[model samples]
Target: MLDPQRTISALRELQRRTGDAQGAQRVAYTAPWHAARGFLTAQLAELPVTVDTDPAGNLWATLPGASDQELWIGGHLDSVPNGGWLDGCLNVFAGLEVLRRLSEQYDGRPPVTVRLVDWADEEGRFGHSLYGSSAVSGHLDPQRAATLTDREGVTMRDALAGIGVDLQHALKAGTQRQKAVAYIELHIEQGPVLERQNLPLGAVLGTCGVERHRVTVTGRAAHAGSTPMDARQDALLVLGRLSQAVYAWTAAHGGVSTIGSVTTTPGIPTSVVETCTFTLDQRHLDPAGLAALWDHAQRDLAQFSADAGCTFAVSPLFQIEPVPFHPALIGACEQAILDVTPQAARLPSGPLHDAAEVARAGIPTVMLFVQSLGGLSHNAAEDTLDAHLDLSVRALDRLAERTITWIRAAERHGARIPAAP
Candidate 1:
């Protein structure tokens, strides 16, 4: 039986260990995250499970079954800088609860192999995101990641070395693994949608596609006071116009566009910027729409730069296409939600997740989201009501049970899961 109080107690313990007054400090590749991992290890110490770590520093604790076919449950253990106590960590701890509960009910062995994972560096401690799940999906390029360095100038290679992950062998690590039949993740909503609707939890439709770019506009620098207004080719001015254009485009299209960072040479009021660079992060739920939007934005930015007498350059960043959840699994989750909270809603995730990577690996995947209080996230105040937390846990446990039964029945009947509608 699922124990809501027990689950909350475990979550509280994790919070105590990894979170402080400032919030969760278990950022990936940091000392606090290692301590958090140690705490997880201790929790699984007495359980009948074989715990292991991959070359990417992802932790896996497996409960053996009759066959190698596995139902995987996991989430990232890492958090953003001073992020909430229950961002990536919530799903990881929820997976732990599933393991603990199932282990007790089944006497340490389930009918199907169940594996719980703590994905490493999902918050991109070393300048990129989705490190561990992408590695497992065979999409992580170790050679490329090797060149990445943290804000501290610490190379990803060196940072990984601290955790015993040899970058050269990272690619080979994912090759030797059991076949995953499905993956389920439980996470906080991280938005206000559910809370505003007075719902405690929801079933995720899918994660949005993301297109990121580094845009650079080059213009001649000059003294701000002395340069003639008509003769000046100020990159900063071009940037301002392009930023507004981006907002306009996104407002018309159904998506989000953010200029996350900006930089300029000789950043002073006395000088016109010679070069201006900014990061563009765009996301949409529809794949084709996302591509079209990006194409339009790129063309607009190029034109804007040319009109301002500035040269334009676009540097492609990483991209993850929209990933829809498995229809059968989503149905299972929806049923579980309905059983607990009949008013629960179905929503698409704007933020990406490790589940997207897992789905890309061709495993059936679904996610459950608990409401985030006041839509607050990435801050110390990020939280869910205790009642909502309990409701989500119960609902997720029901989904897990339902999914296991469905998988077992499918295996017996020699049938494949239904396709998404």
Candidate 2:
């Protein structure tokens, strides 16, 4: 089992050092990623795992198993600007705990090889989540790395240059070894569902798919005080109606939709609104349902534009389908949760994660969520109860043991695992 004290200490150090935006620094490429990477380098030394930087700026810690093949556990170390304490740090430490246990318990000969990866720039602070993980899954283009930049106008190329890794280096890692029988991640629930359910931990029901887009409504800009509302085609007015429709749609659907960012131009609110831009965020567990809502929004956009005598432009922002955890892997996690804790619940992830990238590579993957108090995460206030964290560690141990048992049995028959995918 992972030493709860050690895991807690590791987490504290990561938080104490990095969250401050001082100790470890922001490490956003040319800005502050070094401080972040520096802290990881220091911490992984305790385990003596081989750490390497991939082309896409991923820092990987490999704990060699008895075999060449492996089971990989990963989480990003990057955080949003002034982000939460638990966001990416918890998973990194949790995976480290798994590695620590493997080294101590199995004599470097676990049933399957094990690896712990610390993905860089998963937050897209430099643009793109899973930049590190995506490289491993064979999704990133080496050239695209040069195009990504941070706030200071430093391309990912230049930022990683100081670290001795370029995009060409991060991208060629290859996918043949994506052969892990199963990949798992443990993370704070990032929502209040588990806490509301009063469960310390739970199986992930699924990850929600998100659809984001930019909508521009254009209407004539005229003298604000002179143009009457009944006669004038005001873009801001149309946008207001659009926001109301979005809110109504979210209320009507089982899912949610939001226009988080909106802006109008004229240099003054008192002047007639010429153009308006807004963002729409929609998410749900069902892919078809998400698409239907997306289509619904499109229809609304068209009709609203026509009714308001305005021109509308909708551009795709981000689109991803919901990813369901592997049933078999989830079964192991479910049983492990029950073995380690008294209460367990299942819920969908509201936020995106690396698992979706790995799943796209044809690996059977599952995620486990530890309780986040009040569903609080991504900030200094983000917290998972100590008891919950203990239970979570124990559950990971149980999962590792069960996986070893299955892996060893497979070796007896000259196979790696029962067919997944």
| CA lDDT of each prediction against the hidden true structure | 0.84, 0.73
TM-score against native, each model: 0.94, 0.88
Q: Taking the tens digit of each residue's C-alpha lDDT, what string does model 1 give over 1-421?
A: 6677776787778878888888888888788898889888898897899999987778999998765678898887788877898888778777777888899899888888899999888887765678888888888888888988776789888988988999877766576344778889999988889988888888999999999887889998899899899988888887798778887778778878888889998788899899998888899999877887798778888887888899989877668999998888888888889889877688999888989988988889999999999899988999888888888878877888887887777677776443421
Instruction: List runs of model 1 lying over 4 Å from the truth.
Output: 415-421
Worst 10 residues of 2 by lDDT: 22-31
Give me the overall lDDT of model 2: 0.73
Candidate 2: lDDT of 100? 82
Summarize candidate 2's per-residue lDDT along 190-212 as a digit string, tens digits: 88888787888888866788897
- Relative to the true structure, candidate 1 reaches a TM of 0.94
- Model 1 steric clash pairs: none
